[model samples]
Target: LHGCSAVTYKLSKDNTTCLIVETTATASVSYTNSNRQKLVATWPLGEAAAISGQCESETKGQASLNLTFADYWVHMSFASSGGKASLAGIELFVTVQNGSRFLSPNSTGGLLLTASPKLPLSADTEHFACASELRLPFGQPGGSALVLSATKIQAFGVRNGSLSAKFATCALDARSSVPSDSTTAPSNTTAAPSDTTTAPSDTTAAPSNTTAAPSDTTAAPSDTTAAPSDSTTASTDTAAPTNGTSTAAPPTSAVPTTASPEPPLLNVTVFNSARVPCLRLQLRASLSILYRLKSGGNATVKVALPADTKASGDCGNSSQTVQLSFMQGWRSDLIFVKKASGYALQHLAADYRLSPALFPNAAEPNANRSAFGNGTYFSVASGTAYYSCRSAETLRLDNFVTMETRDLRAQAFRTDNSSAEFAGSMEQCLDDTPIDNVVPIVVGAALAGLVIIVLIAYLIGRRRHSAGSGYQSV
Candidate 1:
């Protein structure tokens, strides 16, 4: 209702068939395609404008008008003829249901629910919302989106190592909320999201007191550095000198300071491995030692590579070294890049990514289909990680990704008695743990040893028989 100059609502990433705009002010409306290019002025035309009726109501919820925009990102920009637009309340309804719901970002940073076939739909169906360009403004808390009663499904943004407007959901609805956006809008649209979001790895190995902080806001935040290192000590910023003059701070000897021991380096080691090139790294975290990095938050993660083998993939895109932050929808590219000489890119390619099996099959009923439900859930699924290979003897990756909630919370539906709660770090680590090789190596070795012993006995018997005359004479 309170906006700078116009009120715009982007309907969905998919093409929209119908749209109903409800507002309390007289303003011009426009539309845009999937690419955000404005279409012809459809709302206020010479003949249509007169018939559309001028909304002169000052009361809230007084005007309800419907328009048809058959495109994606149906940007309905409302501008008043008086050079300023004042809307008491606005509701946008779209008829573009790709079996997914749309939770658009409102001007107030809360999510505004938009639907195609309308709300209060069944829970058995797949319903995920897609916000192609949904993003939070800079410096906004990761917990910006608010969960309203209208939001039937659990929604969390997926960063995918990039802050893209994508979310993943598992399970379906229990309670139902009546749709307030439109009268025709159905109720009970609570469903799971369609897309699959992999969880970020947990910060295994208690974060060291001297963990590095992220200088880049986009990158993961720095691990909590408790005790200052010998080389660098945590110091407060000093005031600038007057008249553009600079003054050097007193030496350490001049000021009394506590001697803080340095924190240890995170020991990132592999937990398990097989004869094959796959290995698993357990992501651990210490909840007590919390570090707050300016740009991205910090988690201590360590990785140990095989002797003479270096990692090469999107996980190590910036360098062989990568930093991970735990912001909502924040993802660190985790698939390992296979060295050309080490592993075949094709071998490491994933068939199809899947949600983590930490939950029951009914919890995430369909492996191929994604849905929304209530509860705070974490997914430990396998999918195309950062690694790419062609064939064997090439780099092999244990396909694993971690999914967690930003709030580390699960809310119960008001209408349903159902709720989901998983124990462990919302910052779960889904590393590919190598399964033990099922080749009968130990059994084969025992058989081979038996065969050798029998052969040796037979040879000795034959030799003794050839020399039997000497023993018989004795």
Candidate 2:
């Protein structure tokens, strides 16, 4: 094991390993296996670690794994290549009987078997795991977790996005053996992120060669330009950059839409919405009610004003934008914001003084009451709100806010063969591509022609006609 230390188990940069004896001086080390499996030699091998060679006389059917020195413990890990590889004459294999497995040593933790294999769990998720905070380290490829903390149904780091972690909990160690070269960006976890992320109208048109397949992705607005005439108005214009993938974007300015006849008492706050670790933009402002767009815009939002009142705006992305209209007398949480496309928004529900997000009725289809509990495997449900508004309370809506609907996904459990499905998570715009109503647009356009013909004919006929003037006037 000492010679193997320099290259293997060093864990400096490359984490490669093979099944090795804990000590180099240890007698011929051998083990039985049913398949060709990759073995890993780990640093800080747990307590006593030793392995006996199957070829050795006294240790024919026995193998031990202990550290190189006395009082040192090392971890043992080996993948089975088909042949049964036994540890201390016992088979060390992974199998799922009732959705889980057994913990080794059988000390403080125990294994959990599904309640009844005859009636297996559904795929769309019908319940929550009964465990909590179960620590699971990464195992080798295709290896599953040994049921630890059977009472609390927690799978190490993976989250089940739904309210319950039943079908949502994932197998242990899903990361690839070779990590990606790309730098990992840590997700935002601030308690209250601000709402300053809207950008002004896109002035730049699509760059040349945006049509063909290209590396830089972005497109331009098909028809329209930045109206230098209207300095107060901001449009959410999509310009061609290259294709649909340019990293450089216009500066964040308020994208104004046609204003409605609403007062300024409304709040436009973004809710943090979900608890899963996601790559979402976080907002700090606590505006009021939020709505989702059913169609149109490429994350381009246009909030129009009624009287051209000079209302201040702010953006909450990468940097904080303070409100020019910040009034200390009024609570800052009273701004209305709608869910627009292209961007994401996040805020705490309490910031807006909103209602407690009502959890789905556990009695309903495929619901689990145990999901919101405090143990492992627990989670907030599909639409459950960590905070809720008081009954008979109303939150005023102020203006449009930015948000992305791409990440929302959902699935239903089939009562039949049992398979988990991928249903997108859009409370609105499930399939709202506007083109869904092609029949209406065509019908409306056809009816619109009669009015145009009548107006043109009336104006032409009313004009004075020159009778016989061409023949005599010359």
Model 1, residue 323: C-alpha shift (Å): 16
What are the per-residue Cα lDDT tens digits for candidate 1 across 1-474?
Answer: 122222222111112211122122222222233454543221211112101111212112122222222211111212222221211112221222112222221101011112121112112112222211121111122211111112112111212222112222211211114222223223442223322311111111111111011111111222233332221112222221111122222222211123223222221111111111122222222111111122222211111111212121111111111212221211122222223222111111111112222111112222221111111122222221212111111111111111221111111101122221222222222333345565678788889999999999999999889797566553
**Candidate 2, number of clashes:** 95
Q: Report the number of the highest-TM-score candidate.
A: 1
TM per prediction: 0.19, 0.16
Error of 2 at 237 (Å): 26
Worst 10 residues of 2 by lDDT: 368-377
- Deviation of model 1 at 126, angstroms: 29
How accurate locally, in lDDT, is each candidate?
0.21, 0.20
TM-score of 1: 0.19
lDDT of 2 at 292: 18
How do the residues 304-345 of candidate 2 rate in per-residue lDDT, one tens digit apiece?
A: 111212122222121111111222111121111112222212
lDDT of 1: 0.21
